[model samples]
Target: MASSHPRVLAIVLAGGEGKRLMPLTAQRAKPAVPFGGIYRLVDFALSNIINSHYLHVIVLTQYKSHSLDRHISKTWRMSALLGNYVSSVPAQQRVGKHWYLGSADAIHQSLNIIEDERPDIVVVVGADHVYRMDFSQMVDAHIESGARATVSAIRQPIALADQFGVIDVDPQDPTRIREFLEKPVNPVGLPDSPTEVLASMGNYVFDADALVEAVTKDAANPDSRHDMGGDIIPAFVDEGTAGVYDMIRNEVPGATDRDRYYWRDVGTIDAYFDANKDLIAVQPVFNLYNEDWPLYTGYTGLPPAKFVHAGPGRLGHAADSIVSPGVLVSGATVAGSILSPGVHLHSWATLTDSVVMDGVQVHRHAQVHRAILDKNVVVDERARIGVDHEEDRARGFTVTDSGITVVPKGSHVA
Candidate 1:
């Protein structure tokens, strides 16, 4: 039986090799990417933890974590005096380790600290996503199920399901997942319904003792892959009972609205761009304005976003976009795009169906469309970027056939 007052600890995995979201993630980690106008990608997880009343949060960081570390220090400086705190535990070469080889290895190296905390449950989450979830509910479900681990599962369209880790569950016992397929070519045949598949949300709650034991044991295995999903969970599941918590609307009244049940894995540049665009929609599926469940982030201390010389006739209007604080859009027409903080748009520069990141300066007469521009990029005057797919490809930029050009951060384009 689980304890009534379980001290839950959240271990956030922020040490991913973000290969797909290149340029933006070339220098910084994926979790530090700006999203939804003002907030970083990892803010979603931290807010969820704070809202759920969990104070002890440990973010495990590695692989170009300078920007991520800075963001955590600036935004998440909680009070130690009040017995609540959030801290980053970077990968140290203390254990004769160069860098965390995998998720399990990261935790394995940190077992001493985890065991010292002596918490009842350990909630592990991937930081590079945009979602609002009450992790306490997942913890409660884990206790109720009396399982070693409880994985949060979501239903997705079958065609896209194979791109994620798909699970096979028993009809009689929905919680009893039978098999795990990591990005299968054909996941439709593995699920009960042909149209939908049960996908892992990468959010997990584990028994603290079981987790520590698994990590220590798995670390000793010579031929193992040393990943949580690849080895730990599957090994524990084969040995004992592990449950699956469906990503359905929770029973928490006035809290778990249907629209609030949103989770995204923005692992690729296209996915990251699309997630940002969703926030600017009129009736966005992922509502950032839900006051009842406010998404908390760092205080900018800056004034609200301002738009100058924006009117119908002037043609310098910002249309269907979110312009964040301290932005100066002067005499430029922006349509279906998001402009992050400190973005300066000179006269006649047009942005259409794109995402311009923080500190970007669009010079006069430049046109950017169907693209994602990283931070601090300077678009020269009269330069037409993301104009045509063929042109962008010829210029050594990654322009998909659909005309989505991805400009990696800190890249120079003449």
Candidate 2:
């Protein structure tokens, strides 16, 4: 028996050209960037939408979207009998001979989808963030509040408010948004909690009719930047119809106090590296083993990860790490790291506090620490990375100020 549900549509913005995550995004779109060894960044957004029972989704993609398109097509197939699908819509230049000018422009160009689906509500989200959210709850809140639009907000420390788009709710009406601040040097705290500011998580729910009208109007505005956060959201806030959904109220089935509300914007290399390392923690900030709200991804049918002993009391060992399927660790030591599928750590190799992507190989006696190795990277025997910043830089590798070395895809470290 089918239960009654609203006609909802989800739009995932996957077109971001992650300039900060260079080398990694040089080939694939930002959403196509791998995370936690097994899943891409887009997987988090799509999985949340699916878990919330929103079956109709449209992933809007642009710059280097081939892998993103392929991943979505292969991994997100829904039942045809139920009229469910997860489609990837490229920059078709339907309105004009131009790619997506901005987030608002993407929606403006894709208004035909809204007309076709005729959904009552539209759930829009960014594809590059890592979080588990129930958009249905936000939708319900939007309907009840009689607001035209609702944006999900995560509470962040007052000190870090400048890094995000801050949302200030109305003093009288706590749920209504009074202002939308973009990376403000000094942001006012929430009405309830003065120590924290509500930052936009780049997730929104809007009435279908209101959204279509807003985007259409934005497209015609010559002065508008055609952005969701900067233009569309500010317009809504000025209209007094934009409400805020505090994420602290969103409760997941298997959430814990420590891991709950774990939303990370892994846009920059350092942030990306930190988030990946968060998984290998003794008590991870984000729990991937939550069967109640599972993170879905494409399966490669690879064999289980294998570890071999080197004999004579030497052993292949790993601690506080996520070793993906098809990984082979023979006489190697891995600690505080993530090894993607098909990675090979040869004898006498040692890796610490690093991320090794798919098909990467660490040759004998190689040492890697506090580094990110892109797909198929080969570290030659006795090659040391993250040991000397000057050497890493001299070899054309990217070394961040925070002391994290990033090797580009398929590169050889000697």
Candidate 3:
């Protein structure tokens, strides 16, 4: 029996090596990659968990996690006096000589943490998504349903169900999962909509004891992939103990109706670019100024952003953009972009619809349009990015099918 006030623990999985988001992810983990200016991809998940008032968190890290670990340590310092903590746990090959085989394996290897804390309910979430969710609501639903595990799902078009791990709900009980289908062809639509299907969001809530037993049982199967979404959830579904939690129902404080339920899986470079663009809109699709549910990140103690040169052509101006602290726009025009901390745009430089990371330098007359520049990247004088796809490709830059140019970290575009 689950208590009404069950002790809940959160586990943020930040282990996957982001091969799709290259150059930017070259030296850092995917969750460590900067977004919106100063916030890392992982911050959104941690912040949401914290804001939900579940303070006991352990970030699971693997694959070049130094940057992610550092950010968690420095930015997520919970009050040690109160025995609350946000600790980063790296892969130590504790279960065996090999590293983590999959997401489930990652958890199975770190069962020691769960055993130590002995929380009643466990919340598992991916580190690199952009959204605001109140897991407390989901926990309540899970307890009410008395399900062994609940998978959070966002409704997607039935046509696109083949691209995601779709959950077929019990027609009799909409909350219970009938089957956990992975990218199935011609998935059945919802009972009401008939046009949408529930797609797994890679977030789950589990009864702590149930989770421990399931993972321990899964560890013995040599054929299992041990992935949470692909294997474990399906096993629970087969046992008739898995339920689905619709994400649309979980509301947060200070969320605008327009931007509510705005969840983005920024797995690729193009998707990542578009997510940033959503922040700079006139009425941004994703509002960052929601005081009741503010996004938390580390402060670098930098000076305020400065804009100078009001003269005719040398005017420093930015419109419909997000400029972080320590950014200097000295005689430049920025439109529909995000400038990270310590970025400097020189005189006559023009940046349009791009995401510029920390300490980047855009020299005089450089033009960047529909692009993503990684940390410390330099755009030399008169350099043009996204102006020519062929030229960008020839220069070893990545140009996606969507025509978004990506300059690698520390690269000089000349």
Q: What lDDT tens digits, residue by residue, belong to model 1 across residues 160-186? A: 775677777767887777777767787
**Model 2: per-residue lDDT, tens digit, 195-248?**
998899999999888899899999999999899998998899999999999998
Q: Candidate 2's error at 270, in angstroms?
A: 1.3
Model 1, C-alpha of 184: deviation from truth (Å): 2.5
TM-score of each: 0.94, 0.96, 0.97
Which is the winner by TM-score between candidate 2 and candidate 3? 3
Q: After superposition, how far is residue 329 of candidate 3 from its true place, in Å?
A: 0.4
Candidates 1 and 3, the one with greater TM-score: 3
lDDT, candidates in the order shown: 0.81, 0.91, 0.92
Worst 10 residues of 2 by lDDT: 1-10
**Model 2 scores what on Cα lDDT?**
0.91
Please identify model 3 stretches exceeding 4 Å from their true place: 158-163, 191-195
Q: How big is the RMSD of model 1?
A: 2.0
